[model samples]
Target: MLAKSIDRLPPPRAGGWRYEPKFDGYRALATIQTDSSVQVHSRRGTPLDDAFPELVGALYAYLPAGTVVDGEIVCWAGGRLDFNRLQRRYAQRRHARELAVTQPVHLVVFDVLETAQDGDLRRRPLRERRAVLERLFRRIPARSPLTLAMQTSDPAVAEEWFDTMAVAGVEGLVIKPANSPYVCGARVWLKYKSRQTTDAVVGGVTGSLHRPAALLLGRYGSDTGRLHYAGRTTHLSDAQAAAVAPLLVAAIGGHPWPVRLTVN
Candidate 1:
């Protein structure tokens, strides 16, 4: 089935709901059919089979057959989420293998879409789906590789987490509708970053850094019809070098987004 995403968590109605703390990482869907084989997908609808190899091992070990889940793939660094480390794994094979041995990997599963052939619950309310998810996760031993995402019904608690996580160098908060179903490709998942940032068009890039290369990300200006290099990230670990770098390069057309920004 085609999976969609929601922009924000919906408000509670007459019925109650379950709210989960959104993890700061890649939004992925994990599928485990009857044979216990697994597949992980990215939000943009790309297969993440090559990106996270270790997770494949974990999924094979923990997930059961005929079950599919929606969740985040996160790497904890210094007690909080680290995008740099997360990006590093995608950089090179050597780094990925090295980090796998050092840091390891974990999954924070939040939703269950299909439990069995009959349990295609994408259309169910978020609250009800979460009920099934919670019970199922509870049955799985905590010492196992998978972990349930932290959640709270209280807005205050959610806010508190947002505050603490921000101070801890985390990315942002993801608020989901407690009663909402898995709306693939939609905006049901609301992502609140520390700063309101957009994926701008990158006109040019800088030279290589510790690993392979650095990048210049930018956007098109409405009135000027020009591309401007807005930001640079030297901390783009190894993973970004291999995956995101090529994509950013390919996105360049004759003039880039605005057709004005140049390499200086």
Candidate 2:
């Protein structure tokens, strides 16, 4: 099945519809045509065939040639999705063997991009796509490498998963408009980042020597007027970070360094 692209932020359907927890992981696009040839692409439209051989093999075995799927590639470790580990395997030289031993890849399929003999379904409603998805999932084997993305209409359940992930050191939660059509290259999907609350001193800012952007974060210090290397927060504007940095430096005067706290 060849998946077609759609706008991400389409209006919701009237009957209301299904809802699924968005995973904080790599957005993967899998395409397997009738000839059994398989292609995997990242959200950025980059090819990822060489990085994950086991995943490719799994897709080849379970999905019919020309089956196209839209999903997230995730690696779960110690009750959390280990994105760092997933990234590591992508760069490993012996990824196949290493992935088998270390962090294994799993496809959390959520949408059916293409359906057999039906022609392009990109512009169709999500319910239509989901019908194809449900049918396609019934045939494929459910195992580690290939599995359906968990779905729940209950806000409580979704909230629980979000809390569990946050406590477990996972990235964050993704919330998608259930009946909304798939949109390519748009922020139609909403992402809620896991905020790590910490107090730190304002650092310095610098203009982008090469680009138009500016930096807005710096290290932390103690009341004793000591300088400590705290993490940077680029969340502020260049003007904001630059404005407060000087005052912060002078307010503390000259003091000795204190203990530091490092977050994962």
Candidate 3:
């Protein structure tokens, strides 16, 4: 099931809700056949076995046959999860083995879709499925490149994790009803992310005065005190463009961004 994005976390209600960390990585489903062969599928159903050969091999070795799990493939860099590094690893066709050694990946399993004992667990309640997933993790060897993601029912605990774990690469929190089943293609889960606003200098624009495209943003560095490219905003409406035009004075000497470009 996919999660629907929300601006803020909702207050807990009478019924129970399970909160789990939302990872900033590729969403993948790992399937272990009856013969112990492993296959990894992306969220778009693209086969990812070749992209992450080591993870596929490890799943085959560690997980029981006929197991199907949902998780994220994450790579760590500079003491935090690096989505850019993961993207680069995903794009590699050759020299994957060498890159695997230098940039090892880990699969953080969150839910189990199938098991050897029970063919399909999607109909089971989330709490029940989580219990089974926890039991399965206990059987994995200590050195396996797999991790059972943490979950909690307490909103306070979820809030704490959202705040504290951000530095450790946790993106946000995903909340779901405890008794709800895993409805495929359903948006039953709620996502909460922390947002903060800061001041940035407007650098440039795309369209003319009548129809401004976007506002090029920049920030002054603390050490150098020079404007640096931050990012760009979405297209502005006609009224917004008119309001912002008077404030954007042409550069007297030189602009921060010399050439037209997008930062990200």
Candidate 4:
């Protein structure tokens, strides 16, 4: 299941909704066969066992056979989820074993897709599925790499988590209806991410004077004191583009970005 990005979190109603931390890591699905063999798949359906051997071993050792789980694979570094470290493991296969021992990845399980006895749980309500997931976690031995993602129904509590838990590598919060069934490939779930605005210097522009394109942005580094490329904004309206054209004359001397602006 996937979540649709929303500008804001919906207000809590009498009917109920579940909120959970959105982890910043690779979205992975783990399937444990009846013979205790484990296979992990990435969001794009690529095999992940080769890059995440530790996770495969832990799932095979702890979770019972015929278990299918939906979760995120995250690497913790300096008390936060380090995506760069995880990407390094994925790209550099030769040193994966050493990195697995030193950095150790964790599978933050959020949903149970299937169980050994009950079979597929996607049709079950989220409340019921969560209960089963919690019970499954309780059966795991101590110090296992598998972790159950925290959840709550209170929007206030969810906001507090969003505000405070970002330091712990929480990307945002996922909101789902309590009684809704898990709809695969459906945008039933909503995601809320904290956002803030910052000022960036306009380095260049695309398009012509009559119709302006995006604004190439830059920012001055505090240590380097140099204008570094930040990013580009979306296309501008014709009127807005014409209004800003007079202000964006080409620099006579050396500019921060010397390359030509290519519009796409």
Candidate 5:
């Protein structure tokens, strides 16, 4: 399932929502076949087995056959989540074993899709699926590479985690409805990312107005009447692009930086 971005965490209410910290790493699905063979891949269908052999090895050892799971592949370094190391692990697949001893990767699972006891849980409520995932983890060794993602229904606890986890590269909270079933590609869940309010003008954009890739921000010197290039944003998600596309307007003639900003 996917999530739509929101500004803030809503106050607790009846049929309260739950929260999971958003890890800054590769989102992947891990599946163990009936024969105990394992496969892990990203949502885009890119196979990750070669990139993270040790993680796959751990999954094969800990997870039972007929089980499928979804989670992020993260690595830690110097007491914080190290995304660069995570990327290197993906790139140097052949050296995975050597690096696995130095910089081991981890799979922080959040949802259980299929279990040995229950064939499929995608159609089940998230609460039920979570319970199943927790039970499955009970048999895993404490030092196992497979770690369950933290979750809580309490807003206060969520807020506290949102504050503390940011230091560990957790970007934000993924708010989920307890009763919602897993619906692939659906934006039923809401995500609240950590951001500071800043004021800047949309001086330009990378993509077309109807399908903007990212905003090129700028600020004008009041007396000089000059547009100073501020900064480009991270690539916009589909939801963000959709929301901003309609609000964008093409720049007219005499455009600043008209030569096309490119690194030589």
Candidate 6:
């Protein structure tokens, strides 16, 4: 199921609402075949088995055949979910096993879409589906890559996660109706992300150094104080470009950044 973007979280008075931490990772749907083989793919139908062979191996060992699950593939590092490391894991698919040993990934299973006995559970209400999911997790070891995601109906607990989970790189909260059924590709659930303001350094500009069109922003790493590309600014006004151009100082020796950096 997909979540619709919402400006704010559900009100405290909202009834029958369930809250989950919006994870900072890749959304994946996985299925276990009758022979205990597993197939995993992203929402866009891209194959993910190569990127996370360890996850597939763990799922094959834990889940029963004819089971389908919906979740995110997340990598935890430095006591938090590191999105950069997750990207690296995906990029280094040829050396996935080595990466897994250094920075293992987890499958945060949230919803049980199907089971061995029940062919399909997407039409069932979430409350019942959650019960089935819990039962399945009972036999799986805690250290397994597949883990049940955290869900709570209490608004206070949800608020606590919303306020604090961001430090661990959690995107935000996803709110769903307790009795709502899974609707594929539908924006039935609501998502709210916490907004924060911060400072960034102007590493470079696009278009030209003299007549820049947009700003390339960077932030100094906390440990090394080395500038890392954070993001780019939106299109600049003529006056904004003209005023900022003079501040652009050329890198004396070899620049820290590469000549060609992937924009996205």
Which candidate number would show the highest TM-score if scored against the true structure?
A: 3
Candidate 3 segments exceeding 4 Å error = 206-214, 221-226, 233-256, 259-264
lDDT tens readout by residue for model 3, 70-136: 9999988999999999999998937678887888888999999999898789999999999999999
How many residue pairs collide in each prediction?
22, 10, 0, 0, 0, 0
Worst-scoring 10-residue span by lDDT in model 6: 6-15
Q: List runs of model 2 lying over 4 Å from the truth.
A: 1-18, 169-172, 203-228, 234-264
lDDT of 4 by residue, 1-264 (tens): 889999888976656999999988999999999989999999789999988788898999888999999999998899998998988888976777787888788999999989987889999999999999998899786688899999999889998999998888788999999988888789889999876579998787777533568788889999989898888888787777878777786666788666775444
Q: What ranges in model 1 sit over 4 Å off?
A: 1-18, 94-98, 195-264
Order of candidate numbers by TM-score, starting with the best:
3, 4, 6, 5, 2, 1
- Show the colliding residue pairs in model 3: none
- What shift in Å separates residue 242 of candidate 4 from its native position after superposition? 13
TM-score of each: 0.65, 0.73, 0.86, 0.84, 0.78, 0.79
lDDT per residue for candidate 6 within 1-264, as digits (tens), equals: 888898877665434888999999999999998878899999999999998988999889888999999999999998899889999999999998887778899999999999988779999988889999999999999889988999999888999999999998898998988889999988888998887878998887788889999988899999998989999989999999999889887677776678777796
Stretches > 4 Å off in candidate 5:
11-14, 196-231, 235-264
Question: What shift in Å separates residue 219 of candidate 3 from its native position after superposition?
Answer: 2.2
| Model 6 lDDT, residue 85, Cα | 90
lDDT of 2 by residue, 171-193 (tens): 55555555667666656555555
Query: For model 4, what is the C-alpha lDDT against the true structure?
Result: 0.87
Estimate the lDDT of model 2: 0.65
lDDT, candidate 6, equals: 0.90
Instruction: Encode model 1's per-residue lDDT on 1-264: one tens digit a residue.
Output: 232344444466554444455566777888886877788888777877576777777777766678888878887877877876776765654566566768666678877888874479989987787778887776667765578877777767766776677755655566666667787667655655554456876455555333346676677778997765677656566677767644553342365444344543
- Residue pairs clashing in model 6 are none
lDDT of 2 at 75: 80
Kindly list the per-residue Cα lDDT of model 5 for residues 98-201, writing each as its tens digit.
Answer: 88888899999999999889988999999999999999999998798889999999889899988888887788999999988998899988999987567898
lDDT of candidates 1 onward, in order: 0.68, 0.65, 0.87, 0.87, 0.89, 0.90
